[model samples]
Target chain A: MLSSPGGNPHHPSTVAELGEFGLIRELTSRLDTTPSVHLGPGDDAAVVAAPDRRVVATTDILLEGRHFRRDWSTAYDVGRKAAAQNLADVAAMGAVPTALLLGLVVPAELPVNWPTELMDGIRDEARVAAAAVVGGDVTRGDVITVAITALGDLRDKAAVTRSGARAGDVVAVTGWLGWSAAGHAVLSRGFRSPRAFVEAHRRPEPPYHAGPAAAGLGATAMTDVSDGLIADLGHIAVASRVRIDVRSRQLDVPLQMSDIGQAVGVDPLQWVLTGGEDHAIVATFPRDRKLPARWRVIGEVLPPTGTPQVTVDGAPWDRAGGWDHFGPDQD
Target chain B: MLSSPGGNPHHPSTVAELGEFGLIRELTSRLDTTPSVHLGPGDDAAVVAAPDRRVVATTDILLEGRHFRRDWSTAYDVGRKAAAQNLADVAAMGAVPTALLLGLVVPAELPVNWPTELMDGIRDEARVAAAAVVGGDVTRGDVITVAITALGDLRDKAAVTRSGARAGDVVAVTGWLGWSAAGHAVLSRGFRSPRAFVEAHRRPEPPYHAGPAAAGLGATAMTDVSDGLIADLGHIAVASRVRIDVRSRQLDVPLQMSDIGQAVGVDPLQWVLTGGEDHAIVATFPRDRKLPARWRVIGEVLPPTGTPQVTVDGAPWDRAGGWDHFGPDQD
Candidate 1:
């Protein structure tokens, strides 16, 4: 916990004591510059080079209790997860990320170190995607919220939108699928032995490069698996006006996830098919196109019969929910 | 007030009932596209044309109770104010608005119409600047937080930053100054009559066009008066390594603001000098350069002093505070 144990007498402990200007300086000074940034932080707005002529943009918000619990995850973990989510969205569009802007709301009395560490996390994760922290606004609020907007450049390539999938497309995905949900299950049960799963839940390792690579390979459609495999694929299905069917056998659930699922009296397939927040890169490519070793074929796109949808083993998965933000609140 | 009057029993009145996809469709359908938007909302990411080969981006967050009061202002007003604040930052960079992205966190039980109306407000305001609603995310949280990211195109011109001010430049401003502070003074007192001032408090009308015009007119440095004239100018002074001194005699305060200030037993000049959130354009131009009639010269920039700062007449303004987000909270 970075929430001040009250040790230092000379240094400011909380954000309020540091003041807005002082906090801005403390946060900005910690970040290094990136090539995409023309004018970085400390300006009215950041100028990011978008040589592609078009900029890909996406935004996501993580509320303290809703998306993450401070008691369960450190501020740094939250920051990394936040950046990964938005960057993944940009990558899903087959755009290489250029810059990220943060809109953060925190309690005035929050430990100054918490936000500073959070900034470090955002910067580090953005660096992973070769993006820079351009600019952001910090305001005082009762609820802690981190809202990130990531901008990307397509580099003369057309963005791979959800509507581009065709009937003869084969669906493939890279990166972890059930790991985050398995981790969440472990955390909820008050056990943390599966460090990998728990870490995935805390900070998602999105396959940022895979997106543009898939685009280069002529992917028809692409999306990040943020809201479960089926739910997000349903977005592609609806947008592309196609039907997608996933083969559960093709999904490789790690032995650890199965063990955790067995311990919890739940099926590991549920996590693989319906879990959210893993941020795996999923794309649809023409059936004749050869996919790389990293891309694993798991499904196929078909002509829309009735309403465009997703199915498991050629049937609608009975469990239909997938991290619907407004569905229900456990807290 | 859109919170169900318990009428229209068949209609889904709350966001929880509306669900995520339905709410998104409802919101996205209301927005019209703009030329800058290569691909609008409803995708993995929106593609915006950044014709200048550089994209200018800025973000801001507005929390429910901290930045706005639901009882005092409608969701539409909150949306407009939210969009205006971010758009003003883009304009402050001498960038013409291109697109806006929203990251909204709302209570599950919030009126469904609230967010929709908020979207309407955002769309209308973006239209005012010829920008489109490109992309966004929505999630449920205890507190309502609207985080907006606005992008702009510089149109092949250099971004006019705060650090460009020169020692021999004269400071000038366009748009309303201190109007929002005076309006806030009205609302805080529980008196909502003086409708124009109250409306200004609800929705600020920023001089977005003046920003690009200033850049074309050879302005040395510029910023929007979002943090009071002195405080924002203080930013310019610090960034430009110069001192700015404002002559109060040259500032013109409306008669209504004076009446309200007198009624509240406060000085209106204090509102004009120290108030924030009018979002007026303020810039410094070479002393010999001619500015169009819209810009009124109010001060001059001088060599760096003991501390590069803004002064009232020739000395520091005693009441130095602006709209410091992390400062003391009124709510």
Candidate 2:
């Protein structure tokens, strides 16, 4: 099971002891406001200065035991991962992340330090993305649930949608591939080596700037790798009505069965193909366009023949396509 | 105990049978778009045009068995109640509600039609507030949770904050006082009567237009009465550093021992004074200002003597202030 931060097993204060308002005061006291936040927490509603006259917004929820487990992820990891996933949505839209609204539901017996640490993780990640905690709500629940909404500005540029791809476009990715899935495999197998993979799974660092940069570079059909590379790409393919084919060799990774892979007893390549939660941005660019230094070409888009599909080496690689919320395994 | 809309007890399709994407498509297909929603659902992020260059944002969470109960309310009631609470926060800011993002977490066995009914409730309430659904996230969880984020525009008017109440300002309220609390009492004691109270509890109809109307008439401070009249007024008192003395007689409510009150054997005034979830607008105006037809004066702000406190009839009313998230009852 995941351990608390202080090392010693001393009992910590429960939320019940502090009360709702008191707990909120303690948790929000650590938040650092940014320039765009005209008003922060404690108000009925927060007023944010949206200088662009347009705001891009998206939301995501993380449920205890579903999206995460206390035994697998620390409280801070949960908070950081939650923020990363939502912010990645804003990035995928070719917008600059600006403000966030967090809603937390927790059990009464939860230690007060857990929520404080979670807020610390959220604020820390927001700082890296230059966003601020504009508002939040706290309530009691049977289990912990975190719902976050991230807002961004388009800065006068058109938002890149998954429907903009065309044939004869090179498919490229800006962040690490299969790392988060690899880390998940390691954790699931009860083995935690290869520090990078484990860390990647716990706290993803999405290439925040690369989204707007790709938009500036005239990239088409952009989306963040959330439900595995192939699954997310399938969304782009269907939306853009284009066929996408990936060249496995083009992915710059040591796909050989390593110690961690052998310990997990799963094909590393399978993880690379269908593993999710990486938060990497995959986009299609005109084949003749010069690629940015951070982007690596991994595939190309083709005109749809019958139905949009994502293939590897011109053949369908049928395996687990990724997570489906209410799929058979869950129920 | 809530019965499905179809009346027949035929087995409804479970969420698992539809999958996440399919369920989302079915649920969101009926959402109506507004002019402010430049980009609506189905995208990674929704782009909302904020012509005022400022956005007012707030969030709230409703958890099953905590904030709501299926045995007492239907899916549509839950959805409408969720939207009403968050939109009330926007109105408390004296802004025009613009858009909303909803995040839903439900058990895999939940009926597919339940979410559709919930969406219908959310959209109907949002229509009254002139807001539209922009984007949302859905996930699988053991219990039902709905987290909503409401966005508004100030339209060049300064946002009315709880910290602006000044001494000699008249306190006013618009909307029902204790109907929701009384409704809660009715449901708790296994008694249902006074259809008005029960309906109020199931679906709060906040005076959405009163907030901006009061702001136009020069309201000094404003807040929604989500936490009993005294408790919410206490928030203004603490934030603005002013003492608020509310006249119990001026509060328009039937404080007599009604049938429900006698059955529950609790003071109706207790609910009027400390009961929450009414979603009424509690605001302050200058003492000499002519009140609008929609506003009723209940008290006046006074300069703080030592510390800010909310008094009733110029005396301290010692009772339960309001609901506490992690109170003794919960743990």
lDDT of candidate 2 over B1-331, digit per residue (tens): 2234235455347878768987788777879999999989987899998888889999998888888888999989998999998999999999999999999997899888788799989998999999998889999888889999999988888899999999999999998788888887777657776778889889999999988888888899999989888889989998999999999888776743255566665656677877788799999998888987878899999989854399889888767444322121111
lDDT of 2 by residue, A110-213 (tens): 88878888988888888888998888999987889999999988888889999999999999998877788778766765778677888998899999999888
Candidate 1's displacement at residue A180, Å, is: 1.2
Q: Model 2 fnat?
A: 0.94
**Residue B328 error for model 2, in Å?**
12
Best by DockQ: 1
Q: Write the per-residue lDDT of candidate 1 for residues A163-202, one digit (tens) a residue.
A: 9999989999999998888888888879886899899989
Candidates in order, TM-scores: namely: 0.93, 0.92
lDDT agreement of model 1 with the native:
0.87
Candidate 1, residue A252: the lDDT equals 94
Off by over 4 Å in 1: A1-7, A320-331, B1-9, B320-331
lDDT of 1 by residue, B1-331 (tens): 2333226677688889988877787788788997778999888889999999999999988888778889989988888988998899999999999999999887889888889889989999998898989899999888888999999999888899999999988999999888888888888888996988888888999999999989988888999988788889988998899999999999988899889977877677777886778799999999898888989999999998866388888977666354332232123
Query: Which parts of model 2 are misplaced by more than 4 Å?
Result: A1-12, A255-265, A320-331, B1-12, B254-267, B320-331
RMSD of each: 3.9, 4.4
